[model samples]
Target: MLQDTTSSAPLRSLLFHLSDVELLTRSARQIVEEEAPPCYTLLIFTNGTGRLYIDNQPFLFSPDHCYLLSPGTSLQIENGTDTVVCFYRITFTVIQARDQQQVLYTEDIFPNRYELRVYPLSRLIRLTEQLYAGRLGKGDMEWFKQHLHFQELIGFLLEHNLHSDPSLSLTQSVENTIHYLNHNFMDSITVKQLVQLANVPHWQYTSIFQELTGKKPLDYLTELRINRSKEWLAISNAPLRDIAHRVGFADEYYFNRRFRQTTGVTPRQYAISMRQRVLVKDWTGHEVHIPLQPLRIIYYGETIGDLVTLGIHPIGGNIPNPENRLYKDPTTIIHDVGFPFNTERASALEPDLIIFANSDERQYEQISKIAPTITYNSWATLEERMHILGDWFGKKREAEQWLVHHHNKTKTMWQQLQSSINAGETASVFTYDHGERLFVMGVTGFSTALYHPLGFRPVSKIQDILDAGQGYKEIQESSLPQYAGDRIFMLLPENKISRRAAEDMMNSTLWQSLPAVQSGHVYMAEEAKWNFGDAFTRDKLLEMLPELLQGF
Candidate 1:
């Protein structure tokens, strides 16, 4: 394992040498065996009951336990449950510092052999989930951020069990004083007050505190107060005097001086600059001045799919069908702002950014008052939407990485399917509603993969329809023979009206005469899977395409 010289955090550098991280689920009565692990394994369970045996000693395990499996330790686990047990398992090799071998010595952290430490999973579970989901480690910078989080987790464990390590005995006292300053930062706190609270001599306490945090005690307090004030300045329109008083400054004039010293700007200038909105020309061409890094977003558009792919579950948003598998939970997790977008409900959520697609222009004025509103063209290219959103969320690198990953997946699937399908075979996608609604796969959405290089080609007739700029043209059943390709995908409609219309087409004599139907090449595509084209659905199509192309 190599040292992480990229990061300044020591614990982060320690975790940079990770071997693997994964989420595992065990069924009821499942028995698992173990050999001596090659690396340290950290198992964080968020649910279910289980038992682990180490050296034939049984340890009762349940939710919120962070178990540490040291190297060369063997264990067995059994889930004694009627329900499934899910846990996140992380395996990493700890690199010992050549000069500071005493720091994070395996023996010092674990204390007992094969010790299964218990830790609270409040924030750790989300971090582990993010790491396992491919949402956190997309690039070098993203991985560094994740390393910092891992460092925080290690620091948390050390904070909880410092009694076992004598080398960090003074860290315990400094941590106590730090906790006091954090809570009392808004109060008139002093260096003497914190030293008195730590029950240590002024000089000794100052030295140890500086050694741990790399800042003087009063400097730390001042930094904390200024940081808190910055948040208020960004989010609130409160007066300077009130904001200054709230963050422990008795006088507005003194706060102005300190804020300028720390931030290189006057407090008033900082507030104005911090809350300054960023302007973006949306697909609708309307300039939207959106707040930076909006924590509360309301998505009222074609799909919430992009937000999810970017790992942002907006505070409130319009949801797709409850049965839409692409969206993890349309009913439970997302607060539904009704389709026509209940303006009152959206306002109630108090979103910092409101994004929608093709909404009535009349509603923009009202919606803008609730928050900075931006509109997107639902039919625009996926790359276009992703670029706009990546800029909005400051995830431009992740967005680009996903595009590259998606492109590779599409290319790979194309190669795999080519081996199973006829050369130059054409495919057409459409749905039967009141009538035949024929769609030509474009460069975006489902079309990106369907018509990607070496993928399926559209029939000459449908190609003309696409060339004519009518995205999805509605043609009669009589024209099926001319437009239907060698292979076809018929998206099943969800509404009863459309289902009945589709049934009529399925029974029509003209439909059976089509080459795809006659040759058994017409497949019923899942609506939830094919309807909206987002990154998640596109990735899923990669997995499903090869199997669907088999024997065709």
Candidate 2:
């Protein structure tokens, strides 16, 4: 009988040739008894009853049965049959088999190997014969033999063990949900709606949805709408209001608000501005053959001046009644000094005279080389800028009259709204991003242009924060003013993170506790319009403010 090896000792092996067939069985029994090497022993029982005991637990084996004993496990065998048990045994040290790195023995080799039967007596006998023949002969290469044996063994096991089990009903349910969302994405959809469509409880459906496709259902739907909207915005010339309605927004205002919130500019502005940068229209129609003299004029930024050159009308200037005054002769080719005035690009596009409004003297120095560049720092003050432009173009007198007319018209509109505003009513301007971060815009920021011009004052604390230069930072760094005010205007972010952050803030206890939140005075501005900072954006705010403020 083989004696037991010490538990603490490392395994050792001795190479011995199989000389006698009868002695092989006897040696196997000794090896089983000793459990000395603490390695695998392949045993095949061809006749008579046999039993293998592991860790003192008996596992009965028949003539057709085979047992693979794991290393480090103790085993004892007993033969109950009167006839000598005919068996074949192989004891090998598992010192890094060559086929170990092959896919044949990888973790996924058997899908459910633990529950399946493998290594029957007949199969084990064949494998042992192959192993014995390969080991005993010098003709067979060790690597090839190992590879063939391992491949055959894995193939046999996998063919019997690996089977797929997927529920058809579950797959169909997911398909239906995806189809419904794709067909009706523009319509307002909620989690509850998806759960209903999937015909599963909300909690169960959420898990299945994520497990199947790795995204929340609503998030996926929102992305679809946003993507589709982008395509329509870029290629289609439909009115924004029509596009908004077609995309399932109940009103153009809300659609504009959401589009801007998502894309940072209004749909019209994004289309027009981006198109202007790349679009070069062929000169068509009868060229009003005017003597094309080089006219010196400076404008802001390279692209801005370039765009203006493309659209400049020769018939209009600061001339009084210019809208009615038509010039039969085309004027000189207008020369641009370049935009933003101070850039290297502007320096390259040298001009005889520089025309810039609302920029500082620093911007004027670069163009001073070409000619005396006029600086108009107060251009941001709409009235002042209009006058400056009018004067520079030899239409100062005409521009003053136009300014007076529009100023009166705007003032009247402001007075009308003010007359209706309830006493002590307050307002605040704030912007939000997709990440849910709120930015408080001061009275001076472009956001407050509509309200501030109309004699509406921001709440004291809001103004103080704005005055302290605290509101212009990115949303994460800025804080929401404590004053609740009667009304709050918020600009939203275009990206998903900013949107989620803004939504999180809206649902937070801190936000709910604020007076605006409590009174439902919060209003979201159209993101597209908010981003443009153009005439259309200004017009939208003007139209929206009175109604929004009235509710507060």
Give the whole-model CA lDDT for all candidates, comma-separated: 0.66, 0.46
lDDT of 1 by residue, 1-552 (tens): 001122222443353356677656676679888676767778776555556776465554555556677776677888754435667778776765656453332432344423333244434554564355332244688577566656656666555553343323344445556755654578888788776665566887889898877999988888988976876776677788999999999988999999999999987787677565777887667887887656567887655677778887676776544324443321113456777779988887657788877647888777888888998766666787788789877789988988888778777777866666777888887775443453444334455457655877877886776576444666776776777888877776655567566667777898888878988887665453466677677776676666556621
By TM-score, the best candidate is: 1
CA lDDT for candidate 2: 0.46
TM-score for every candidate vs. truth? 0.51, 0.34
* Tens digit of per-residue lDDT, candidate 2, span 270-324: 6655332111111122112211121334444211211132232321112111111
Q: For each candidate, C-alpha RMSD in Å? A: 15.3, 32.8
Lowest lDDT sum, 10 consecutive residues, model 2, at: 316-325
Error of 2 at 282 (Å): 36
Model 2 bad stretches (over 4 Å): 1-298, 301-372, 378-380, 415-420, 432-438, 443-447, 450-455, 465-478, 495-500, 531-540, 547-552
